[model samples]
Target: MSRLRVGLLANPTAAQGTAHRIGRQVDHLLRLAGISVVDLSGPSAAVARARAEDIRDSLTALVVVGGDGTVSLGAEIVAGSPVRLGVVPVGSGNDFARSLGLAVNDPESSTRALLHALSRPVVSVDAIEITAAGHSGPGHRSLALGNLNLGFDALVNARANRARSGHTVRYTTAVLRELRAFTPLPFWMEIDGGDRIELDATVLTLCNTGMFGRGMRMVPDARIDDGVLELATVSGIGRRQLLRLFPRVFAGTHTSLSAVDIRPVEQLTIGLRHGRMLRAYADGEPRELLPLTARVLPGAVRLLAEPSGSMTADPKDSQ
Candidate 1:
């Protein structure tokens, strides 16, 4: 067997320090599986990411022990490299971990699932490469492994992230807070090198792994390895109607609604028409403001996940 060194990177305070609590268990499990552990836990995300990249040449795998934001760190470091990305799922929304059929909020079981994934074939997944034209210098380019949120949903994700509460509760609270002042924004978008069209979008997200806000299937048919990304938009609806549609998102039945537009895009450029301020967030982390371009990179991530039965399991996954 080849020697394995798995860098265990985690957020100590995610889910109220549950990530650190679970980190110990995950570290123990990896050691038992004959893998050497490199603890990469840091007080902040920027420190953790910097450390992971500094030693990326030595690690065989970088396993993130938190939610999607933590996964974002791992994906940024190991994407297209020999290192594989693993998820342990202890954050507010374990969306990526749930995508792999792992049990959320259960550390030991999820760790065991990680071990199982290590022994399996590498699962190559697509990722989004987002460029923020508004920013200059080295930080302008980034990777979004799950989904990118724009318009109203981006506001909700940013709001929910600030609260110190459970996943569903914070998301619900954020939705209510944002709804009180919600209005459609004028967004201009171009797909596949085509002409730009103006859109009055309330919620716009470009999906790779899809689900966000814990279990909301913002794009039901999106597959991470399908060589494409999903541009899901919600528009032309009142606050009451949007609220009614929110519940359906969890079940992925909102695609049936006329207000929802789902487009399979390989490349797209987006910006505000009137130059208003609108931020785009990827993997639930703030990426950049408007004037953004994104494209799908098929097989960009070598994910440590099971090979089958872990994606789009809902019967209503289709529109």
Candidate 2:
């Protein structure tokens, strides 16, 4: 048989030394497996210049070596294209990568798992499309394979981006710092003609996959190919309540809490009361705020994963 052509799009800033280490490992492994690998690391702006269709025409699969944001960008490129995607989880919150049963901490094992894909068939997964009317330009939307979060979750992500400290310290510190000043916002959600549920919420997340923020199971029962988005929200809960409920995300039973709600729907619209600049994040990167619609873009991307049974980890959720 012939060699399979592969492409990689990585985030250069995820970990201090992630780029160099992951690049060498993946390149060496795939080459040993007789596959051609193309590396695309550095500025994401380059994605606009690179023709994904042209790359897809030549490559058998495209592998991403960064965080959810980088993978989401790859989804935008391969949404309607033919190339399958492989993810090497080397970023600080490898949520989607974790969901893929890809190794989050073990580079060698993950590369071995990825190499297995060369002889395997591709798998299809669901994604969400978030459309927002921003301050300028045509209204926009981006593809997200893991989660679309609003309110407090968005605030945490924003802080993580602005943090001057290191990754572990930055995210945790931001969460604790924001908790002191985090003000729950009132928003309205309308799902598929369902009555609008008004809420003063700390966090409202529409989850496609089961994990986020380094294995936080915000949506424990979420399944990417289920043809629906699992909506989970924590309304106006106090810090004590958050502490009480945080562990349940890992087992997914937090939904039973009076303050938390979990439901599934095909589409949903979120709007703030006074139309404030409510932050929104899709797959961990900041996107435009509310006055937006989130709809399911089914089978939007092709991903590589071991067959379901070979996948380890209890599907237990703690979100």
Candidate 3:
């Protein structure tokens, strides 16, 4: 392997224990490859990011050993910097990793893939900078590794995030339950500084990799390095229509539906037209609030992904 100084970060309790086990596996393999590995898995996500930020100048790569949430943490630490981002997907939702052609739920294969990636040069991909104010305080910024979900998907994510555990079953259950209470959320969207368009959407998401909810393809044409974002929404749908439309998402065939719309833009602004505030979610974590501004930051991150001309993380979110 080439000369490498890697920082491995993992949440011990992530994915019910897979993260801890995989972190050790990653560390062992890196050392065996004659690469120096640093344990940056601090007590919490904040600590881990702080540690990474402190030593980022010395590290060639920051490898996240968990799911999409943990990967988002690594991106927060490394985006727009010299350090390359690496992923070992052991989390419940490896949505961010699947697009890179990496193995899921298999520790040996995923770690071996990372080992292979380390021997090659990193790949450049786009990131998103989403900025919005909190509900009661000043605004904060967040990096999105996979997507920024609004409407029904964000509603589901908000529910999943509040659970004792973040899992596919939890998210899926939330999806089912939210369907009953979820109404058409009317919002105003201004894409690329165009006029604000009013629409009621059931599932509206700004996608990077187009994969979320544990490999469900919300936007099949989304490309990580495309230098743009896709605003995907399914509007004008009732409960029964939505029920059938959602299953098609897993097959990536929902786009064929007339109600489903996908628009590519460099920047977008979305907010509630009237109702209560709708929370924004990315990679199953909550951030900011509606009246959010998001844009694509092309080539903001470098990743150690399996070569396929595509595979991607986050830019510094604006306040």
The model with the greater TM-score, 1 or 3, is 1
Model 3 misplaced stretches (Cα beyond 4 Å): 133-139, 164-166, 309-319
* Candidate 3, number of clashes: 0
Best by lDDT: 1
Q: How many clashes does each candidate structure show, in the order listed?
A: 0, 11, 0
Model 1 scores a C-alpha lDDT of 0.82
Quick one: RMSD of model 3?
Answer: 4.4
lDDT of 3 by residue, 1-319 (tens): 5467889898886788768877897789788878889998877888888888899989888888888888887887788887888888887778888877788777677667777776575677888788873222212567787899988999888888776654767887888889987789989989998998899888899999988888789888788987998999888889888888777899998888899889898988899987669888888788778898888988788886655635532323210
Evaluated at residue 181, the lDDT of candidate 2 is: 68
| CA RMSD (A), model 1 | 4.6
- Tell me the tens digit of each residue's lDDT in model 1 across 222-296: 788888988999989999998999889999999988999998999888999876998888877898788888889
Could you give candidate 2's per-residue lDDT for residues 197-283 as a string of tens digits? 788888788889857766778876678876789888888679877766656776767767788878888888888887677779888
lDDT per prediction? 0.82, 0.74, 0.81
Instruction: Identify the leading candidate in terms of TM-score.
Output: 1
Order the candidates by TM-score, highest first: 1, 3, 2
RMSD of each: 4.6, 5.0, 4.4
- Which regions in candidate 2 have their CA more than 4 angstroms from the true location? 1-3, 47-53, 133-139, 193-197, 309-319
